[model samples]
Structures are given as C-alpha cells and as structure tokens.
Target: MDDHRIFAESLAAALAAEPDVDVSAAGSGPAALRCLERAAGEGRRYDVLLVDADLGGHASGSRPAVPVQDGDEEGLVDGISLVAGVRAAQPAVRIVVLAEKDDARRAALALQAGASGWVAKDCSLSRLLTVIRGVLRDETHLPPALLTGVLRELTAARRHRTESERLVESLTPREREVLRCMVAGLGRKAVAERLFLSPHTVRTHMQNVLGKLGVHSTLAAVALARRAGVGPADLTGDVVERGSQLA
Candidate 1:
C-alpha cells in the first residue's frame, strides 16, 4: 500500500494493462489490511503485495476507509512493521517492499519480515514487474547496490541473537522465570506475587539473573532477553494456575 494516491493509481493502471496481471491498490496500511481480509473472506487471495516502505508512519493524508478494530496493530507505525503484520495475516502472499531509496538496514529488516523483494520506487516499471514475476517463482530479489550492506546488517543481527541466547542459557530455571517477569516490566513485588515466591527471594533471583546475564541494569537485561527471542510472561490469565504450571 502507498499513501501517494497518484503513484498508487498510476502503478495499478500500468500493472492492470498487462495481459496476465490483476492489480488493486490501497492508500494506507489499514486499507491494505482491509483489502487482504476481504479478499481472503471471498476465497480470492492476492498473489503479491507491493507495499510502500514508509506508509502509515508519515503519510501526508492517510484516510482508512473502515474504522480500525480495537487493538489492531495501529495501521503499522512503519513499513517494516507492516511487512510483519501482512506476513502474519497472509503467509503465502509474496511481499515486495517499495522504498524511496536504497536503505540496506531497512531492506534487511524487510527481508526478515517476509518480504521477498526490495526495490526503489524510482525503478523502471519493467524492472518492478520483472521482480514481481521472479518472486512468484520463489526467488528473492534485492537491488545490487544493497547486497553488501544488507548482508552485513543481517550478519550482525544474527551474531547478536546468538550471543544473547548463550547468555540466557547460563541462567537457572528459577532465574530465567524471574528474568521473564522482569522483561514483562514486573516489579519485584509483582514478580513475587505472580511466581508465588517471597519478595526477598524474588529480589535475590533478579540479582542473580542480572549477574548471570552480565548486565548492570534491568533494562540492559531486558534488551538482551528480547534479542534472544525471549518474550514477556503472559500476565492476564489466572496467576495462581499459571504459576502452578511452571512448577
């Protein structure tokens, strides 16, 4: 989806002119998600989605046609996040990110979010169409200029994730639980209540976790846990039962 109406419509028209293409356009991330949902409901899913890399976050005038459902992903704060949202909703659809310029960092993130191709918006229509066809055939495409930097960015992320996982692996099971609660933004008292431990015991566990993770502060530990793919403990359910399961 693109916020620029003129570009969206013109590109749609151009693609529609092709003998084997069917094109649709949306001017905002919410509108784009709506289109995907509607198409899925009708049993006619889109084969490819070309998304503006900067939609939702800084669109000049994005007017979603439908009222957003409460707690829907906020029309995607940025295109990278929208790529992830679309991937979650439609796993089979090939996604291509359209950016204003070649950004290796954003392109790497887009690839991680399931985009099969990344291209500059100023690229020729013929080039974009070719990439679309290529992705449909299960080939990934990236601009040549972006190859080196994108690879570097992805490698660095991988290294961080690996190191974070190693540090997290060093914690004891109880320490790990305490760390999970900490990542959820729970205080020592809250963690004690949820985990059914005494507050002093919780404090000891938290300190042990920080020491094991080799972090000086809770915030640094939280960041490391996230890099390790550790998510917060669910706090909404019955805490008594939840704590029992962990036992």
Candidate 2:
C-alpha cells in the first residue's frame, strides 16, 4: 500500500498489461487488507503483494507511530509493520516492500517480518517484475550488503547462520541437491528436470528438505540455507560433483 494514488494506479496498470496477470491497488494498509478479504471471499487469492514503506501521509492530523524493537530509535510509520500485518492476514502471500531508498534498517525490518523481497522505488519496472517472479519462485532478493546487516541483526537475536547450519547438517544428500537448485531460484518442475527426476520425486525431496530444515515453505528453507552460506554461490561445480558422488 502507498499514499500516492497516481503512482499506485500507474504501477497496477503496468502490471495488468503483463500476460496472465491481474492487478489491484490500494492506497492504504487497511484498504489493502479489505481488498484481500474481498478477493478471498470470491475464491481468489493474491500470490504477491507490493507494499510501500510508507503507507501514506497522516489520515487527518497526526502521523501514526509504528512500534519498534528494543534497539530501534525511530517511531515513524515503518513499512515493516505493514509487512507483518499482511503476513498475519495471508500467510501464503509473498510480500515485496517498495522502499524509497536503500536503507539497511528498512531491509532488516522487512526481513524480520518475513517479507520475501525488497526493491527500491526508483528501480525500473522490469527489475521489480523480475523480483516479483523471483520471489514467487521462492527467491530472496536481499543484496549481499543488506544481507550482511540482516545477518548481524538476526545474530543479535540469537537467530543466525549457526542455527541454519545445524539444520543443514540434518538434510540428506538428495535433499541438499534439491535445496541447491531451490537456492538458485528454480521452480519444482525446473528442479525436477535438471535433476532428472519426476515431479513426484521432486515434491517428495522438497517436503523432506522442508522437514529437515524445520521450515514450512521452500522460501524459508532457501533463506535459511543462504543465511548459513549454502547459497547459489556455494552451489559450485565441486558441490554438484559431491552430490553426484552420493549413493
């Protein structure tokens, strides 16, 4: 949700022009929630949501003060709050925060709220669309810079790569192969094709991967793996060779 009516409408229009896509717009967080409810009532659900960091200007008088964590200093309207609210409403909907600038705090907050992606507002529509598709395929768009900071933030809360590493150790060889492809942003069919496996086999591997990782979704598994440094960068030829050597 955003306060800018023109910008929101323009974005919705552009997205609607894409093939096999439907677009809807809301100027505020509550409005967006209402739209989601209405869509659900009609047996429809959104796969992704693009939320503005700032929901809008003050409704009538005072700007809303967002709740912050122990170390957070700012009390202004935090878009991360909206991300959490949206997650509460629709746990399955992937969320991408539209940031006005590249702020580390904003990125960290979004990640902490379980947002799937974040993109600067000034980024090209093509980039945003790519991010949307990527997130839908369970890819996190966190740049290395932001990821470093987010890792530190999570570290402070006793939730960091160490935990992910522990979980990773529990994965089977086949499950690690599945996770490797997943971290590379491959969908189930693509992963199955690449691994020379049937779709049913891929699904089973994915479920085992999720269970071993102690996560509910593929995105969470990939995120945890990346946080533990078992990301696309680590899925090198040597890694592939190791997987192949497995019985």
Full-model lDDT for every candidate: 0.75, 0.67
**Model 1: how far is 234 from its true place, Å?**
3.6
- Model 1: per-residue lDDT, tens digit, 39-110? 668766677777777765445654221111112111111244577777787677677888888999999989
Q: Which residue runs does candidate 1 get wrong by more than 4 Å?
A: 1-3, 56-78, 235-247
Superposition error at 96 for model 2 (Å): 0.3
Highest-lDDT candidate: 1
What are the per-residue Cα lDDT tens digits for candidate 2 across 16-133?
6766566776555555666677767977667777767666434532112221111111001124456777677677777777776777777777877778887887888789778877
Give the clashing residue pairs of candidate 1, or none.
none
